[model samples]
Target: MQFCDDCGSLMHADGDEMVCSSCGARVPKDRERAAQFVSTEKQTFDDVIESSEEAADEGLPSTEATCEECGHDRAWYTIKQTASADEPPTRFFKCQECGHRWRGYN
Candidate 1:
């Protein structure tokens, strides 16, 4: 067990230095030392969490529209909403494989 130099509390190995959990004190820094021992080591972590809203905003596929004629996947699609009695909804699609053109209004 190591003792803190500042508060004389028990210190445990936290990371790079012995830290006192109760008093929240670590090893004192020596400004006189310009360079010290250096080592290249890999750090490991057990768990990580990320926000899902960031993924959705990055142009990830949140929703997909399937073509009813040939069942083709598309990166971009047009959205059509329901129309009132005086107006009618219109959607147009052109297929490259079968050279088919279809449209619906109503």
Candidate 2:
């Protein structure tokens, strides 16, 4: 990106020129200027989003977990990392009927 010499604000890449928004000055696009502002290829990364649907997917064992809010008799549970590596993982429960979520330490 280029900056306006007059107003010191960032300039945008307009068609064939770099136009300053604050000062309305136009800098002609050149090979050296384009090379200085070339965009690098974006690095691919894995998505870090964890969803409730993905967590409650089929194959998890169902135990009789009572919902504290709605009194539902069923829920899906999974162990999640909540502490340091030396400690035991915590159990998370989601109610089947009312979708109430709770956690148990043991």
- On TM-score, the candidate that comes out on top is 2
Candidate with the greatest lDDT versus the true structure: 2
Candidate 2 least-lDDT 10 residues: 39-48
Superposed Cα deviation of residue 42, candidate 2 (Å):
27
Full-model lDDT for every candidate: 0.50, 0.80
Candidate 2: misplaced stretches above 4 Å? 1-59
Residue pairs that clash (backbone atoms under 3 angstroms), model 2: none
Each prediction's TM-score against the native? 0.25, 0.44
**Decoy 1 TM-score against native:** 0.25
Residue-wise lDDT of candidate 2 within 19-94, one digit each (tens)? 8999899988777769777643454445634455755444576789899999989888999889998999999888
RMSD of each: 16.0, 8.5
**lDDT (Cα, tens digit) per residue for candidate 1, span 31-102:** 343135332344444454444643322333222334557765442323365566567666544443332445
